[model samples]
Target: MNTVGVRGYSLELRTRIVALVLGGASPGEAAKHFSVHVDTVKSYLKRHHQNTLHIVAKPTGRRRTVMALHEQQLLAQLETHQDATLQEHADMLETITGLKISYKTVDRVFRRYKITHKKNTGRQRTP
Candidate 1:
């Protein structure tokens, strides 16, 4: 989100504006005190007094997938058993935890976590 052209006014400014308004000072008087436009003062006081202003910043970024502790343990198992095939790992995880993840998903998870796939070390036979 962009916060352009907004001056760094404190919450104290809003509090002072509210105090002035409550003390029978006109909106124009409050605006003159704060050096802001009358409409701006009105808007600020309206928001501050209404108790409906949301000052909290909303959460951003992608939500993480909620994995169980057992799922994490399964991932650790995969890290130790890199020689196992994707299908083998998937089947084993499913059997152990009843979570049915696909072989493609297992491969994707490995890649996503930067876990290298097992490299072939056996000698190749010539045709």
Candidate 2:
């Protein structure tokens, strides 16, 4: 059984597998023919059986902070307070929005926005 990428199967392939099961192909048969795990075929068939088959399954996770309602305000705060450390940024966000967040969250937001505030690590020339 081939499990190539992270999600294992592409959306188009998943849809096709589900369609095959619906068209009276046994899940195991479909799995062998497609070189996919039988369990994976069963999962697709389950969605088909439950009438919840989607060509593109809705993403299943928390939405990104960058897409939050307060994203613009957060970006502006980051821009205006360029020298603030990650902890400071988190505290500032808490103060302004009453939403306390971790320094890691601040770091992740900075990374997502391509904002760089890291101190230079190279040694300076002696005077």
Candidate 3:
């Protein structure tokens, strides 16, 4: 049997799998319907049943700070002025918004936006 790519599976496929499992459809039947292996269907059912026991919500990956559009514009300005240090950026943001943000926070935002401290030249330098 060919291994199914999880990325290629859609929401509809997930719903179908859940419905088939809950409706007491055999693993083989469910697998045929989903175009996956019988073992895959059984595994999904087992996982679904296990998850239903505890029902605790899973924690999402790191959340980003919610910055306003104007704040983003200010960030752009800071990026253009590469000479400005992290402390300077933080101070400027605080002065404008009356919200004191740490230099680390400013640095993280810069990294997330791919705005490096040093601008890259088109020419590549050899070692």
Best by lDDT: 2
Off by over 4 Å in 2: 1-29, 32-36, 45-60, 63-67, 122-127
Per-residue CA lDDT of model 2 for 1-127, tens digit only, reads 4447534577788889988887899988998888889888998888777876564455567866544745566687877876667788788888888887788887787777786665655633222
Residue 71 deviation, candidate 3, in Å? 4.0
User: Each candidate's lDDT (Cα)?
Assistant: 0.68, 0.74, 0.67
Q: Which is better, 1 or 2, measured by TM-score?
A: 2
For each candidate in turn, the TM-score is: 0.39, 0.57, 0.46
Q: What are the clashing pairs of model 1?
A: none
lDDT score for residue 73 of model 2 = 61
- Weakest 10 consecutive residues of candidate 1 by summed lDDT: 1-10
Give the C-alpha lDDT of model 2. 0.74
What is the C-alpha lDDT profile of model 1 across 11-127, one tens digit per residue?
677678777887999999987887867776687678877873335334565543326554575587776875677788888887877778787867777776776565545633222
**Model 3 lDDT, full chain set:** 0.67
